[model samples]
Target chain A: MDKTYPSIEEAIVDVPDGAVIAIPGFFAAGVPRILLQALIKKGVKELTLACGCGPLLGATEELTQLVKNRQLKKVIDSYGLFRSATKGLQDPFEQAVRAGEIELEVYPMGTLAEKYRAAGAGIPAFYTPTGVGSIVEKNTVTNIVENRKPKETKVFDGEKYVLEYALKTDYAFIHAYMGDKEGNLVYRKTSRNFNHVMATAGKITIAEVENLMEPGEIDPDCVHTSGIYVQRVLKVPRIGFAITID
Target chain B: MAKKFEGLPREMIAMRASKEIKDGDYVNLGIGIPTLVSNWIEGKDVILQSEIGMTKTGPLAFNDDIDQDLINASCQPVTELPGIAYFDIFDSFSMIRGGYMDVIIMGALQVNGRGDYAGWANPAARGLDIGNIGGSMDLCAGATKLFLTMTHTAPDGAPKIVNEISFPLTVKGKVNMVFTDLAVIEITSEGPVLKEVYPGLTPEDIQSVTEPKLIIAPDLKEIEL
Candidate 1:
């Protein structure tokens, strides 16, 4: 059994700078605020943060600030957190994109998830039906074709295909309901967002637990992420949008 | 019959027949005057589930308490209820597509004789474009009962509820009732029947506003002002 840390900074103390980070939480529901704060306080730069709709998940605003402040290089994402916050992406980072300072790659949600799973499973790329004729599959290079055809056929219809490149990561962050000294995480209510998938998507997974329980304390069936994938655990605070199903 | 809320659009009064909404009913309110239904619902305990996730969503936030976090379908902040269960956009969509919706009230830009609906929002554009579809496609197909509340005509004084619609449709023949400030009309398979009319408005007046030929339901009566 490992010792539980009081704060997330200690939990992810070994995280290297410029590493790809897979963040859990969905649209502010499972955001590990303290864990994110630790990462920001460390002043790590040029890192790629991966997650599903982080803007809605609660980290978008902060990440935008980091990008705008030149603390990070780029973001592979779909939409910004704020609808009315900034000129374009509601972040200074987007202004930088306009100025050619960084690359803002927009990944449709499914494409983003598939790419991460592919990388985690050691697969190079995968095909998804998320962005067929949408603006999602444009700009630069790879074109993975789909074997399926359209409802109606014609020339110049381009192709009904999506080539999702891999989404490799160095660290993952999530907020769980409970955790043991060894880092198994449990989630309550809607808190079970994308934390489990994000955990396996990274090399080093750091979890911020609202409560620290003994090993096997949490029901085996409800245990989402196991201690095997999690490297560190931090005891944190419980905030909003909580519902106890148990 | 109900006391009309002052300052509400003429279209809202016609749609207020939500008196049929019983307790424990799951209702999805589409944008337009249909959203005003939440404010109109006082004595009923019907569960209002928004397509954007929040259930029984409150009005816009006053301050930065805007909870940049939780919001309704219109991209507005909202309060969370106790029984509410948040889900992925895809799963939430499954609920709508699986026909879990009981009643859906939407404001239509156009309602043809067949009761086809066409209001997809910001309809001023010639192209089939909107910020997002959310679950309109699913809601229209899934909801057991559908209601429409809207003005009698377009801003250009052209009729929106009519024999034939010019714009693209969101769902076909999904509308059961159409409500305007002048009158309430029910669309059966046969055609539209004038069900009720507002105070100070006559059946002739409603007929003038309505584009499709209106048949007076035998029990047609005045609406409560």
Candidate 2:
């Protein structure tokens, strides 16, 4: 296990087309931007991407541009459409969704994170009361569950709960504040949003770090994602050092 | 924004909403007027929680003090309090779904007679597309109580306190109280009870815009903001 990779392309070279991926970040913080750029440069098609928010803004143009180029076939996320109410704004992903070019599934903010956590823990499914009487329970698609298992809606002690399946992906691309060659990762502030959960939910978790420390440099209590869960780590260029990608 | 509704100013609405929050309560502040409540409750002992996984988060950060890495659910930079703790999205939401949050102050699009409010999606715009339902559903279901902050009327001059919501409903019958530009209403089993109206507007003016059966308080007076 020395899982460190030389470059973003080498880290993601084996992520074949039609793979499911979980990209961890909320808004502009802690995203695996270089990895996403590598995917864009790789020109892989028919992808299924999972995130806390769908097709993030304020990050890079790579993922949205990929969607614009008709690369993503499906998206699983919590906040899919733009949160604002003002009409006539153009989002290419939303346009693709309306035009039947992309399939979309939305989860409650809590449910989205919990599903991934459950997947990482090897749980099959769990019930939650988040969407009891709303449209989320009424119209939620059940086919996303593994084995195409039919979701069951049951009442527990008078509260309605919907069975949400654990979500696992082929790869998880994450950004961490620091990492060791052995793959232990630490995240900064609120940027730790989904990266910790996503780190465990992917078959192959790849981390892009701002700093790479020695094995004993970081405090034992400060580790966010342990080395046991991460499969690959890429020490990216330090801040302000321009990284050229071919 | 919309001619001020001939009622309380935005600050007064925030002040009134602040009064409803108890000391030592765990609150989730939504965007808009609800965020202003934090500024008014400066010295009061309230623990602010953000769904993006920070508890005991302090006031909004000044531009110079802003860290792009430290942001609230609204994507605005915030400072951490003395006892601030950061967790993953799983533990953060588990706190909400486990009913540890005491109150949630959120903005509203439309609220119906039954106290159900629609805050997330506008059916008129995207027609049931996956618009931002961020933390509304979880907060409504798991929070001990829910408070709403909104203007009395839509920008199109239509009533927002309607008999039924035309937009997609975020949560149903979970709203305990609503603070609006015109009046303060408490949602009871009977319907929305108008407790106080702003000074310039009459019960009739508030009633004209409210489609629900507005039961005026026995001693309705001007809001003391």
Candidate with best DockQ:
2
Model 2: runs farther than 4 Å from truth?
A85-88, A141-151, A238-246, B1-5
Best by lDDT: 2
Model 1, residue A87: distance off in Å is 9.6
lDDT tens digits, residues A1-246, model 2?
688998888899999889999988776666777788888888999998898854255353665778866779887777766655343146676667666677767778888898899999999799998877677777663223332233468988987798888999999998899999889999999889999999999999999999998899889899999998899999986442111110
lDDT of 2 by residue, B181-210 (tens): 889999999888999998889888898888
Give Cα distance to truth, residue B102, candidate 1, Å.
1.5
Query: Candidate 1 on A42-96: residue-level lDDT in tens?
Result: 8877776766544322555565557655666655554332333233333455455
Off by over 4 Å in 1: A1-29, A32-60, A63-173, A181-206, A216-233, A237-246, B1-17, B30-93, B106-130, B148-175, B178-194, B202-225
Taking all chains together, each candidate's TM-score versus the true structure is 0.57, 0.93
Error of 2 at A57 (Å): 1.9
Q: What is the TM-score of chain B alone in each candidate?
A: 0.86, 0.94
